[model samples]
Target: MAKKAYIGVDGVARKVKKGYIGIGKNVYGPELLSTAGMPFMALANKYYATHYHVDQDGGFATLELDTLVSSPADIIGKWWPDGSFGSDSVETMITSRIRTAVSYSGLIIHTEAYEITEQTVGIARKIRKAYVGVGGVARPCWSGGELVYYGTATALSVARQHLAATSVGNYALFGGGETTNNSNVIDAYDASLTRTNPTTLSAARTQPAGTAAGDYALFAGGYGSNYSSGVDAYDVSLTRTNPTALSAARTQLAGTAAGDYALFAGGYNSRGFSAVVDAYDASLTRTNPTVLSTARCDLAATSVGNYALFGGGQISSSSSSAVVDAYDTGLTRTTPTGLSTTRYQLAATTVEDYALFAGGNASGGYSTVVDAYDASLTRTTPTALSEARYRPAATTVEGYALFAGGFSSGGYSTVVDAYDASLTRTTPTALGEARDQLAGTTVGNFALFAGGYTGSFSNRVDVYMVS
Candidate 1:
């Protein structure tokens, strides 16, 4: 049996060598086996011992036995022996003491260079991965750690947690946040998870929010020395441009794409928790929409095909609130089902027509409860995250909604969870570092979490492969 399925180094599954390899069998006796050259594959079966061997050039060789054997195909391998058995045991046994050119013994295994196939490599069911050697030699490379091949393993790029992240097409940019101090650093990650700090933000802003607008991306209000009103915009060419500031500076806000516009809503301003909802057109001009029904900050937001919704946040007095706000493509405001569990500093992401809200701080403490909202805005509670956390990051990657890194009840978390279309939650992998207050976005097939408060505020970026 030939295996066609393989997971490449890029985390993409592929099929290789899509045709059958012909292996014909021929039995060799004493005379034919003595001078057999090149590599030969042999299968010893029960019944009167008949050895079926095929040479590298596909020539057939045979070995006839007088006695009967109990088992068949037990010692199946391709061996390159020089006429003499030397120290070979499986071949030496050859019908229990029946002498062959190789050896005369029992249960002899070919100690010389030999090859095994997927069918006989281990328990017959598992498909063995084959490595095509230099110069076109193909052989099974399984059974754990036999040889090391370059360019066959997955690669890791820098992880930028705690920083705000947004993507367009095949690239994602992470900018600003606390890393040692409130960081001014800005970087970009490509579809392959490669990281490069191509440009700098005009201002150092932490806990900022961003969304893609046309071919460009806008980094809206964040916390600098104080709440920031400055907005930074980057286009397809990575050009840095300025957009008008919000009517008031704010940080920890939730921003999402609404039709062709980007809307930034509820967060803290100098005046306290903000109810201001700022909408920006493609030109980055500001348009104030109806404010959030409930004034709050540290909320999470995500856009469905037609609208954007903001869910869960801290209300006026650092108190967690579970209220939700839905904005139509026209920027009209409507109330949706509140979170089953009241929470703040939560995260949300969408897939198809369903949006999932996960991991936030509730009344008692940090909450691990997860809730999903369908197209009609009905709420369905999914399985909770592996760890209860607050201020984690969320995004859609390869059809799965991912939540990564945050401050959990156990402290800072590096845990990452993925939700499939069925709303089933699975912890596929962990972030490189533990942190929170971060931002996340998707580009191509990847979901990324960047910049967050690890110990004393961090600027780490961690990536996960969802494809």
Candidate 2:
């Protein structure tokens, strides 16, 4: 007599080989019973699935198959097997809609993990719910099926303004600003949102430009005792070192990183407003790149994809300039489409595929304009800020680019405007204090707004967190 077992097919129990199993749309048959089912015969030769279970509805199933060579519990930390999307180490897995491993333990249905950008979690609710079957392609995990976030406040060790900020590895550093006097203070916030004060800068200075390349955050060229050309580099351990100095000493220069290079460009030097550019590679080796098309100070800089852009600055004491200079990974320079309004003191940051320049003094008046440039350098105008302001500090966390605390007709603003990856604008909680000339940076899931003037120097650090 032929051994037979029952499997639910389309909600009906059907007789099949004893070793046969079904998972989602894939059915498997035992080696000896390879000819048993017409629909499953082709796959039976390929998969040696000895163990499986299906619910009466047949919509949910679990299977132990030979191809994976192990059980789900053993598969943790393994790269998901999919060629088209490449792969990522499985960071986590969840079994239910509740979305947490601890909360959803009772649900038998399991979800598979993939490495999609974590910020995509906000849009995850629009995706259809799915289940995983071993040896079959699984849906990519976005935020492990749900989203939640909270905010925390941390204070900078020192109250300061006009500082430079950048994140490298696990640390967000705010360096060189105005305190009671020029500040050498370098305040750091780690991934856990804990604050620390690292070694002070080599010189007390204000308006230094900060950017990161490779593992180091470099703060360069600001006014100290005089227009200074010093460049300080900090590695992952928060160890600081003086790198080769900038080609020229300057203040209010625009700094941004692209590819392996940290670039400091266009500022007022001792000579006059200068168009010089200094580039530092991963090893802190300095190189002089072709200068900006227009020499100006207070230009905002940010990188999207392969290009770093420096845009909108004060051309002279009387006029602002709208010219935008772009540099690719190779250090080749080009001019992208200019800003919609000629403005300087605008804030710039990158989120997802867009680099945004927002709100600055245009000609003489505070401007609310927000110009966005996609990876191709194509420019578009997003919604204007709710408030007209200039010199707002900007940074990105998750998919949100936040422009916070700037000077306006009303005085310094506490306003924090956030633009999501889709360019939609939302107002998050305002800063803990009304401030301008602050420094903004991010570490882990937190966006930190720290150090600015609010009638007085502010050490207040408002952190926005996304989980």
TM-score of each: 0.65, 0.72
Question: Local distance difference test, per candidate?
Answer: 0.66, 0.76
Off by over 4 Å in 1: 1-162, 456-459
Poorest lDDT segment (10 consecutive residues) of candidate 2: 115-124
Model 1 lDDT, residue 273, Cα: 89
- Candidate 2 clashes between residue pairs 3 or more apart in a chain or in different chains: none
Candidate achieving the largest TM-score: 2
Candidate no. 2 TM-score: 0.72
Tens digit of lDDT per residue, candidate 1, span 301-388? Answer: 8877577889989885757788889888898998888989888878888965588889888888888999888867888888888888
Clashes in predicted model 2:
0
